[model samples]
Target: MSADIEVVPSTNRKNAFRRRGLLAAAVAVAVLARVFMFDHQSLDYIAFIKRWYDFIAANGGFGALKHSFSDYNVPYLYLLAALTHTPIPVLAGVKIISVAFDLVLAFFVYRIVALRRPGGWLPPVAALVVLLLPTVATNSALWGQADAIYAAFSLGGIYFVLRRRPWLACVFFGLALAFKLQAVFVFPLLLVLALRKWLPWRALPVVPAVVLLLDVPALLAGAPLKQLLSIYVQQAGSYQALSLRAPSIYQFFPAGADAAVIRPIGVAVTGLVVLGLVAAVVLRRATLNPARIVLMATVSAILVPFLLPSMHERYFYLGEVLTVVAACYLPRRLWYVPVLVQGAVFPAYLDVLFPKGMGKGGQPGMIIGQAPPGGVATPPPGGGRGPVIMGGGPGTSMYEPTLEYRILAALMALAVISVLCTAWREFRRS
Candidate 1:
């Protein structure tokens, strides 16, 4: 009897040690990811800090509250403006608030993953992947972008939807949308909930209602609704001079393609693609797994910007965050594709962050030369030649791949192929 008891105790001890080891490993991964991605001194973070400080100082305390609404519908600006009233430097306060949001997002990701896979390491592992994702880390921690905060609230809204808390979900979703319009991409998922009768159809109106409620403060501050409409119009009309080279129909065209021609075609094509994805989800609803549905919705969102004529690298934030969530739930092999795509964009970001020249015109290839760390030795504004314009002026341009651009394009192509194959297979099975 004594021997039997000893053996049982020994077995329990082994199990305990295994659990402890796994936990330690997870913590180590999280630590490494945080340190590598968010050192607080990174160039992206510093730039964001500077920008926030300048805005606050120029406007005077609470001044941003009045002016910020004109720029973006971001409700978080009010919170930041409030924080600026504190004795701490506005920039530092912004960073602290941002960091706090990051931690909260990480927690949500972990919790959601855990809910899906009890006692499995997938939750923590997913959180680690999210932390390590180059774009997410850079945007959230370094650039002080609100993508992380919005994504967290968005995911929380999804969680509430899953839990059958429709009202709460709508409120959170409203907040997420207020931060960034990209949050609308998840609307399809909510529709799924409504169709399935998991959420009351009546709850649907709450989303737009919440948005209007949040906008009331700005509306009262003499912020014309037309200004908000104009922002969307400007975004639609203007083309970004520089963008990550992702695989899209655009690649088929000659380099230096005219924005006038590209913009309309891009919009139409992207719209079709989004519609197709939505149809696929609706058609496969009977057989589709929750994970697959979420993944498809996310891929659709990511591809939309690429399909649109004028896309900035920052636009990828919406898709990248969702991809990270999808990766966590997906099989291991599927995860690597997004990981590769995420890494591919880093080179482009590096190019932008450490541009070859400053005073030079923002031309494409103009190598004004490198600037040293904190060195003002480079010619002051207007001294150097502008960015080198790649491709011949107007017609007769040949496309050449920069190492980073080529890699990014290739990775995006791979992602498209993988997703297509998976979707096709699932469709056939159904």
Candidate 2:
């Protein structure tokens, strides 16, 4: 009996060591992959980020915050200002910041998966899956966008909520909202928890409070208080299109239809859909569990962007990441959830990054460049119109949906339904 006990411990130790080695290997590979993508200059970088870096560098670094240089919120701009003083090349530095958060995102993915699948290989492997996921890597490393920052915080919020740490969850959610309005994609999930009274009402105020606290530095730097607070409001009004090639429900709209007439209907429908999901959560509150909450969050992340107006292609970044976590929670049934969501979102990235078409004979090359006389181009006041269309003629909107996008729209719709149904079944399970 003593020999048997010793043998079991030895075997468990060997398994644990093997898992750690595999996880280390995964992180090394993920980092190397991102290093290769570090040099690719995306259109958003050329048109917006590069100019903002220069403006921050030229205008007393942090002092530039006072001026409305970028449409992005103060939190990200603060990073740019700090980067101005660093020796690292601005392009690489920007991606590195996001890459750090990419790892943070993966860590949270691992933690969340471990909550249910503890001491197994699946959790470490799930972290690897998140790091290598095409959109996750490209959004930060290739595109140099900060989607990963808000995404990391949002995932932290979800993880904390699952741990029943409401205050921490609120703080993370607030940090996410401070970085990007897209963070609201997960807000519905948090709201559902609040309604169920699982998340305390006192903790709810922490979110906006964290956002406001993060804004103080920029406010002190001379950024107008009113304009600073209204960044998201301004962003919403800046775009006129119903959908920015986001593979959302708007894909069904007729070409050249008046956005003014269609926008309100889309908003109202989105509100109704959100309320319906919230109502479902309320009705099934008794069956709620960590796994069910994860699925509900997945539905919110995907369905909101899938239904809302004026969404960008990358708006579903949160959904794509959460699908991986949801699938990890119930691998047998939810494995295809990430597959479908990633499949739908990846092509949209290609549409902007390799707009020349990644088709049978298409060559991947720069589609367009709009640099100023001697420096990177600056986007017009609100923000640059969505990324450039390589071969499309004059007046072409980058958000224009193709047949492929329409097909992906169906896939995204299916994903949202799949997750919602899974949550419903979870509620029904004995």
Candidate 3:
């Protein structure tokens, strides 16, 4: 088909085009990474960087790592301690860590997609699409958040589980939960797998063991065993709001909603939805295929964030990657899935970075707390204008992003339903 040569090139024009596209995507990632690398955008970088660095400087960095009370667990804190002593600007260093994982997350996503949708441009293109998602980019590079860290491991765990590597999958899941509690987004799916007999219950013990493994260093240090064990339990009590300003069903309630009542109400509703899903999985146990199970996991990832009692806007980050897996697996006509999922997430980032400065309770100066030797001696971060957005007026609060988030939440709910229906249909076909 070549105009200048009688014989075709060893690599056809189509193959050449695909290679060119992949190269272009790689270039785009590099340029974007550089842009994010230097942007100095978030308060999280300022606040946590100093707190962590000071923790290292306060006593011995190793002692700080052993004590473990940074709201995040040992795995992340250990890395922070190491970086604290490094010469790199703490903000840039952490953001770089986040950004680098963003690509690893992209790689795992590509592997998941390629496992099912092999050939042509789908895998690479899908990975680029994920890397470029506004929420994904903003959460790591701009907001300096670590959702991607958990997401990468969770996705890999799911992938490995499907590949029949149960112990590896368990370890990956444990790694995810160790990074962040939101990693529970995929926790329910593991439950579904255990019920489906894809994973043996005997192998399930590996999860807790791995979690203990992550905590071993802290325990070995003088860190109270009670503190290490109750880390998540106490974190759950830190915010009592029905929504904690999450983009979900709770957003439909009146702006002045009461947590005492609304919390129980939300739980009751979420419980019913989860029960419905679990029932569906049980009914389809015999027919369960990897794609269907993936769809179920995607459903749980979205549903937990959507229906749960005390979710934050970023809690649903798992859906972003899991849907990609499901899309490529079913290769279903569901392009809108990721679109709807991320709609609320990026807006919440804007809400925090408001020009007015984190809107109320937003304190001034670097924060060091839980009052350790290095603590600037400020009180422990007492949910003050906590980076965790508390309840707000509909459009009435000085920080008026609530109304925008409410509208987006409703649309995201619809998006959840649409994807579920599409995946359910595919499950039946499977």
Clashing pairs in 2: none
Question: Candidates ranked by TM-score, best first?
Answer: 2, 3, 1
Identify the runs in model 1 with alpha carbons over 4 angstroms from their true place.
1-60, 68-70, 191-200, 220-222, 228-231, 238-252, 358-403
Q: Give stretches of model 2 more than 4 Å off.
A: 357-369, 372-378, 388-395
Q: Model 3: what TM-score?
A: 0.86
User: For candidate 3, lDDT tens digit of each residue in 133-164?
Assistant: 77777778777788889999988898898788
| Native-referenced Cα lDDT, model 2 | 0.85
Instruction: Quote model 2's TM-score.
Output: 0.93
TM-score of each: 0.76, 0.93, 0.86
Ranking by lDDT: 2, 3, 1
Write the number of the candidate with greater lDDT, choosing between 1 and 3. 3
User: Which 10-residue span in candidate 2 carries the lowest summed lDDT?
Assistant: 358-367
Q: Mind giving the per-residue lDDT tens digits that candidate 2 earns over 1-430? A: 9999999999999988988987898898899999999999987788778888998999999888999867899999999999999999999999999999999999999999999998878888898999999999999999999999999999999999999999999999999999999999888888889888889989999999999999899888988999899888888887777788798988878777789988999899999989987986687656568988888888889989998988888999999999999998878778998899888889888877766532223433222335534655435436644454333444455565568888989888888888888877787774
CA error at residue 143 for candidate 3, angstroms: 1.2
Please give the lDDT score for candidate 3.
Answer: 0.71
lDDT of 1 at 255: 51
Best by TM-score: 2
